[model samples]
Target: MPISSTRSSASRIPLLDILKGLACALIVGHHLVFYGPMSDVAYPLAPDLMDWLFAYGRMAVQVFLVLGGYLAASTLAPQGVARFDSPLQQVLRRFVRLSTPYLAALMFNLLAAELARYGMDDGSVPAEPSLPQLLAHVFLLQDLLGFEALSAGVWYVAIDFQLFVLAVAVLSLARFLSVRWKAPWLAPVLVLLGACASLFYFNLMPELDTWGVYFAGAYGMGMLAFWAGHSTRPYRWLVALATLGLATLALDFRGRIAVALVTALALGVLQASGGARHWSPMPALQRLGQMSYSVFLVHFPVCLLVNALFNQFWPTQPWANAAGMVIALALSLRAGQWLYQHVETRLVSMPMALRMQGGLLVATGLVLLGLKAL
Candidate 1:
């Protein structure tokens, strides 16, 4: 099968974009309350609202996991069998695409943290990065290595990359088997079984949470959803996917898993019924969706800056703290736009080898500077 011909060139799915935008906004709000001192000031005014946002808002990441799986399947194996040349090359390409902007954002975050340090002492201020810690983060192993994260939500980046590589491997295995067995449904069945194991077994183990396997259930659901949506027997596959997801949740009830299942089902139905077209024409939300990754990368530092400033200037003013949250949100969006254009777009266009060299150069420079400062 010719690669491009089997690939799905489905029009940009507006529904998915909308969901991404909404999830990004929730994540930003979650960080603002979870990280900043400003939330302390605003909490008394709206305790219930603040508590909810602080507690459950981070679950928005489930949305991204589902979407990532959907998009990965759509690109790599639209018919549920990998057609790419080399999984290693695919992994390298994805690493570059994710890490280039990630490194650039870390630099900005370090600068912001330094500047914020001069303003106030609060939990929001991350400790100064050591040379080793910086290196760990550069390799996206800070969490696994037990180093404190330089920025909030960075764990997701590492996990996202891991999930992509794992998915590619599974798809590649299916492709290999397809050469021997000419059954068109063999690949999808194998992938679904893997997903079931993830959901019912791996996901139940909290110790595996740092690894992609813990979250593979949800990510795999997204992959299954994508294939199911596009299948010739769309209704049959969609029903099967939903039933499996629900059964897994019933076996081991997790609120987050429930949320993931719902998100996956919604995305599957939207794609199946062509509801991914212009159902809701919110341009701003669509733009947010486009920049969601950038927003995720940079929002923590932006929130830190605002929190430091608010504590310094209006420590007792509750309303000022509320205003600062709004300012932080706006600035995060603006910063995301700047980062996407100057950092993400440029690096994504470069060859993988060049991008890796550039990232290493930047990381080495930052680490050396941090060591010197210490």
Candidate 2:
């Protein structure tokens, strides 16, 4: 859900990285318990902990969505004005950057799922992908086109792309309106209105989840937090951000939205207090945060692999399955580190991204076709 190419090494915000890291860990833990024979076997040992992780751990995504918006704002529209001349170029670049690492990770996931299926017959093992399903995923359209995701959290990748396009379009139009009327308020006002609309209307409809508007509330809040954080009147902007979120909750409560609101607000406060820059984070947290997107993308396949191993060898050993959860987490972090270094850190172009995605599709299709033949 995040690969912030916004700030450079020197300008990186520790707070953002720390939060993203913590959120990434929760997301991984949540899935370890969720997509598991491991967690199923170990559940009786710590039902309350397992229950809580399953129930609320996924909400950590709200943190990523919010942080993604915040970073997007910093990169795309720091001044609440459109910086890019061509919105298409901005979006295309973002797509390329996102998809490069994404397709690489998808390739790993596809192989991992196949390996897991070979090992165990759990329902969580994604079935062999059809051609159309693979094509939709290549374009980050699996969720939009109603294909079963090849892996968990794939929908978020599509939604992230969609939300970025929406933000660019909205802010580009705001720039046009701002110049035409000479009103600075047009940009933030439009963004705020979109956020309000989502929080009040679109977000309530489960059907709209595939689109950006459904999650625009949190994303917009993050955008606004950027503007507000750098504003002359930071507290005033903070108040407005808080007020909008509170109003939404007062009217119709949603725990996910509540987490988003809190995350945005926490970021705002940190930025306002200069803690975003000055706070020294532990090395581990910062490293994890820096590679949070990598972890987010790759953790699922690792979890599935570990779960399959447990299913095959230690299916009835509760303690062993519990240890498998830890093993999965360690392996996930290692896999993410490798992905970050090998793929995410590369200077990939549009062509390269397309080639990787094409390779992913062809390779994954071959695996599926081979299985069918057998």
Measured by lDDT, the strongest candidate is 2
Question: For model 2, how does the per-residue alpha-carbon lDDT over 1-374 read when each residue is reduced to its tens digit?
Answer: 11122322225568788898899999998998889688999999999999999999999999989998888878876666767899999999999888888887887788889889877888888987887998799889998888999988889999999999999999899888889898766777898899999999999999999998999999999988877777777778889899999999999999999999999988877776655686765779888999988998999999999988889989899999999999999999999999999989898788877777787778877886686578
Q: Against the unseen true structure, what C-alpha lDDT does each candidate score? A: 0.84, 0.86
C-alpha RMSD in Å of predicted model 1 compared with the true structure: 3.0
Clashes of each: 0, 0
lDDT of 2: 0.86
| Clashing pairs for predicted structure model 2, backbone only | none
- TM-score each candidate: 0.92, 0.94
Residue 257 Cα positional deviation in candidate 1, in Å, after optimal superposition: 1.0
* Model 2 regions more than 4 Å off: 1-10, 366-374
Which stretch of 10 consecutive residues in model 2 shows the poorest summed lDDT?
Answer: 1-10
Q: Which pairs of residues collide in candidate 1?
A: none
lDDT of 1 by residue, 326-358 (tens): 999999999999988876777454476466556
